[model samples]
Target: MPPSPSTRSQAAAPPRRDRGDACPGALRLHQAADGHLARIRLPAGDLTVRQATALADAADLLGDGHLSLTSRGNAELRGLAEDCGARLATLLRDAGLLPSERHERIRNILASPLAGLDRHTPSDVRRWARELDALLCASESATALSGRFLFVLDDGRGDVAALGGDVSLLAESAGDGAGPAGSALLRVGDDPAALRIAGPDAPRAALTAAEAFLTAAAASGSGAWRVRELPDGHGLTARDVAGALRSAGIEAAYVAEPPAPATRTSPPYADSAAPGIVEGPDGDRALSVLAPLGRLTVAQWRLLTAIADADGSGALRLTPWRGIVLPGLPAATAPDRLAELSAAGLITDPASPWHRLGACTGRPGCAKSRTDVRADATAAVATGTTVPAEAPTGSPPSGVPVSPVGVPVSPAGVPVYWSGCERRCGHPHGTWVDVLATAEGYRVALVDPDTAPTAAPAPARTAAPPAP
Candidate 1:
């Protein structure tokens, strides 16, 4: 018998979705302004040497000669030919990148990129992610999940647990060499509370919770694509999820406001690990690098794949921060390999201007953008004009706090998002500077800076960012 769910109603229902999610997938290409865009889901951002080469080849032969990295650790190919869908699908399928066509779009998973590689991490959430992915593809019921549905696997290091996951499995501390057999917390949506269960059972528990969401969303008839979209007074709670898990014979201990990792990061996909070498506790080493502006050419992509194949492990770990980690590297040859990566235009230094900056595909790629935000942002960074992170297209918010002259950034690299318009599509959460592209130039504002602001707001300026 199935247990009843304890629904928690919100004060306000989320905006209703009348249409199906059009989020692009590998087979289902999206027609962008540049051309067809295909988003390839890499579960936990795990990529093999062969798979990486396939992508690079696809980008060069079919689409533009570039690969774009997403905040979910996935890769995107833009400027693709309108009729290249069949060839693209076949390439990915042969590489085993597309396992189940039916379940391809629903395989949105994010995990700690440094899982099993860093000393601070006690468990390898990557194993859990692989398990969950398999469960998703096998379950016919999971096919009903929206393409936008996301699952986050966070190791005890607290790297990727809070990037707005629909179903988040946070690995609890299991001491040294606990592996993946430790206990974990299963958090649904953004609820501060969680339900604890065995680590080995974490994957199953995640699937169960997601299934519960489907049931709730169906009952609500809200056409919600994500758990957070459930209407007010019709939401699922920790109690509801626990009831579902227990029905499956999985034990779930409830924790009111589960304790978060002490070293947690805010949203907008900040890179917790700097670009360079990461040493595991066992004396193993990995070479880390970042893509400038979250876009990579096939040349750069192949270079990374070659470096990984030669010096590091044959696998590439794509971080949620839009970075890559080449793990299991030979210690003696890592420095030379890293030098090669740096020379090839990859961001290898933490202090590099490209480290904390991100921008959407504005200008020619996106028809909605007012201007080329990326070019302006690059210019801003070059001139030391303090750049912020991503923003979307829409009207600017009134009564916003205005930023003072100059884009001041923290030493730890607070990200600045640049958008062609006001949608603020992928902007970083928490406090950040808002640099909106106005017809005159860029309108700079201090969004959610401090408790509030005083005095009159600064006027928008038309001057181009001065050179450094």
Candidate 2:
């Protein structure tokens, strides 16, 4: 199970933020040891061929030769030249990637990447994501939101429901003894209660929910940048948010109890040990491609574009799993494309060792890192011993057991993430295997049910000291 909102969003003893969030954006770059880092938020992770190609060009020309996929389904360019911001901005602008400079960082939205293409989804909510993005950008008050604030649009499959969204719009099943058909359940700040509104009003309702949070945060006067950051006594309720929705001309009524959050699990398309081709009901298909360690070279990205151009809709959706979903492909052509992608070093088969591993950019790029975590992760993956035993049920201290350091754990394809230090940046949501770099070596643990690290006394057999 995922952690509660308070546990997930709030650090131990909530710290007040007197300054704005330092999250990087296309316009605002972060100076890293590698170079400048720029994050480009793609609303709903929608990327056209032109925009993707433009990003590839920027990566090759203005930044590093590769693009980094973020866990938010956004893209980041590292090793960026110090003076290339203007050119990069112009290129992104020309490709329609940057719509609002002021609202760029605040546009952190993650939706079901395979919403429309998947058969199990209730309805396509990609349009809702776009509409909500536009609404958020249009609202001048929304500019006050911290870049860390997030919004999630789920297509009733729960794939993205547990991703810690500050505001969430989940689709309700029609004719299932639920209120009205096609109504969206809008909840703010992980509150179980929701504001039920027509499907068409979901975007406006989400915007209104943001406004309500902003209002409450303002009242707290704690400079709360997110709903969770507001003072403990602050109240967030469906009725209050519904009232705000009504003021925004979005008809919403309070629901005493909304449906329980969608189960947090890997999408069916990726439930196996490796990502594979997803065949739709109508013979349409999508090739699920994973980037090794969430890093893609320009040539590899171009290869993806070529595959999409040849076999898909020329559209790719970046997933929060640090992967790319190429939708609208003919079922017949998917197999060949997957083969080609696999041959090109992309993880197309779930059984591949790369299927279970991910890592944060550790050394060189991050000044705080004690070791090159990515290199260590790659070495771990190469050993095929990355999977860990099931996560323990209770909260425990965070560290690996040194008593049985060389014990071999069978492969279960459990998701394992390597972090440079304690922060565990970009770790996957839900229960996952965690490997943290430490002075003693690497500490491996399965994140506890409470989302705290529960480390055994021994590291897995694959644990290796990070390269200097």
Q: Give TM per candidate.
A: 0.86, 0.88
Give stretches of model 1 more than 4 Å off.
1-13, 175-181, 264-270, 385-412, 446-468
**Model 1 accuracy (lDDT, Cα):** 0.76
> Best candidate per lDDT, number?
1
The lDDT values for all models are: 0.76, 0.75
Residue 62 error, candidate 2, Å: 0.8
The list of candidate 2 runs beyond 4 A from truth reads: 1-11, 261-274, 386-413, 450-468
Q: Model 1, 1-468: lDDT tens per residue? A: 011122212123475766667778898888778998999999999999999999999999998899988888889999999899999999999999998999999998999888778777754588999999999989999999988788988886666665768899888774523323488888888677889899889999999999999999999898888888898777888889999998999999998867665454333335566799888878879888999888888999999999889877799988767789999987788889889999999999987877767677888987777998787777656665323333333322332212333333222435666767656555544344566677877765544423342111232111211000
> Number of the top candidate by TM-score?
2
TM-score of 1: 0.86
Per-residue lDDT of model 2, residues 74-158, tens digit only: 9999999889889999999999998888899999898988787766664357999999999988989999997878899887767
Q: Where does candidate 2 clash, by residue pair?
A: 273-350, 274-350, 401-456, 401-457, 401-458, 402-457
Q: Locate the minimum summed-lDDT window of 10 residues in model 2.
A: 459-468
Estimate the overall C-alpha local distance difference test score of candidate 2: 0.75
